[model samples]
Target: MLVETVTLQIPEILYQRLVNTARATQRPLEEVILHALQTGSPPEWDDVPEEFQADLAALDKLDENTLWQIANSGKTSAEMERYNTLLEGNSSGTLTEAERLELMALRHEADLFMLKKTQAAVLLRWRGHRVPTP
Candidate 1:
């Protein structure tokens, strides 16, 4: 690609956002702004599964605090205990119909929770937050 220099003035809010991203990523402000311009979103949602695209896409509108809270959340201890028991029963082929249904519901809910958490982390990182791995 050929290099071209262009000068432009951006609003204060946009400039602050770019500066924040640059700081969080430990990169230059110009590089962060350039990446944002080229990729649209720092984190791409287009490649996510069709069923999850809408859910993930909506995270873009969330505030940083809310996204951070979500990124740090997890299933409750009680829920995890129950889910584990159900999973063990499933592996043993000893689950009753009601138990099986409950297990499936729990499994689906867990999947959704994990996906949401991952999306939230991605958004936080894109918005210049240091999202640590779980």
Candidate 2:
């Protein structure tokens, strides 16, 4: 990995917190600061499943407005109605093959939607926005 060095200042309290953490963890201050920098920025998603990694990686480059939009967006009413109907059919074990395939596709889309929203919120919070709890 390429490394770059930049000089910067931090609040005294924040510096103190980093120093304290380093001491507690028996690590050098630089190591602690590097870890903090990496963690405080958008995630690398190393431990996440491969399926979710690409979506999350893309979010890291998005601007704040785009991230906020993603964080707040949800399903259309029509999509929600269809998804719910499919779920009901699934629960009752009455789905035809076509409906079953539709449900599977819808479920995957729903999963991706939720993952994007969550990642957007996390990035917004990390960027120091006041993300309200829902």
Candidate 3:
């Protein structure tokens, strides 16, 4: 296949580093640049610098909550609106210190209530009784 050549004027520091990398890896500078461009993100394949490998490896171990929305993915539009409202109310600075403390207490109590309900539902299911919640 015929390949087209395109010229890019990169900063001298970056160009020097790319050339040094090519020499170290025993790959053509043009090939290294092309591979890096194709990857769009560095550390995709053979052209990544050794200095970045450790940081890249660390990124590979991100948890689902950090990388993907798992629990909140199933929320409907109405549920999302309600959640957002609660968050807004809780975060608003207009609340006095006493009101803020009360809000925090209410949030904590709601969380514990939900936890108990979930446990009860699970137990009911195990005992062959239908438990319903939305």
Candidate 4:
């Protein structure tokens, strides 16, 4: 792939830390910085406010909601087709309530995956990883 070079300004301490990390991992400085850039958190905030911070339990809830939104994007017709396919595959009797709920959840997750893909593409462009088309 054709790549473009860009310069970044970071604090001396952070630069030294990156160098140390690269040495420890036996990787180049560029590689270490690139890895950090890819894994870094979204740039919505420099630091989150204490009041807005959600604990692990809240994070679980947020994840569950995100999954539900993704999975339920299919319309009624699509859902029926999915249900029929499942029934066809499982010739070993009726589905339990919990099993049925799980299938619905999976469908919802399928919907969210599309949104996540778009999000990743946008982020990549913002981070200069991918060239954005005009």
Quantify all predictions' global Cα lDDT against the true fold.
0.77, 0.77, 0.48, 0.50
lDDT of 4 by residue, 1-134 (tens): 99789988998755765665455446688886787688762222113434333221122222323423433443478767776676654556577777667666765554444444344343343333543333
Model 1 error, position 106 (Å): 1.3
Candidate 1, residue 74: CA error in Å? 1.4
Worst 10 residues of 3 by lDDT: 64-73
TM-score against truth, every candidate: 0.68, 0.69, 0.33, 0.30
Per-residue CA lDDT of model 1 for 71-97, tens digit only, reads 999778988999999999999999999
**Candidate order, TM-score descending:** 2, 1, 3, 4
Q: Cα deviation of 32 in candidate 3 (Å)?
A: 66
Candidate 3 error regions (>4 Å): 1-89
All candidates: CA RMSD in angstroms? 7.2, 11.1, 17.6, 12.7
Best by TM-score: 2
Question: What lDDT tens digits, residue by residue, belong to model 3 across residues 1-134?
Answer: 99887877887755764565465446687876776676432223223445443433332233323222221224368755755565676677566666667666656545544443443343333323354555
Model 3 residue 38 CA deviation (Å) reads 54
- Once fitted onto the true fold, the runs of candidate 4 whose alpha carbons sit more than 4 angstroms away are 41-134
Per-residue C-alpha lDDT of model 2 across residues 36-59, encoded as one tens digit per residue: 787763344546778877787677
Model 4 clashing residue pairs (backbone): 70-108, 70-111, 70-112, 71-107, 71-108, 71-109, 72-108
Model 4 lowest lDDT segment of ten? 54-63
CA shift at 13, candidate 2, in angstroms?
29
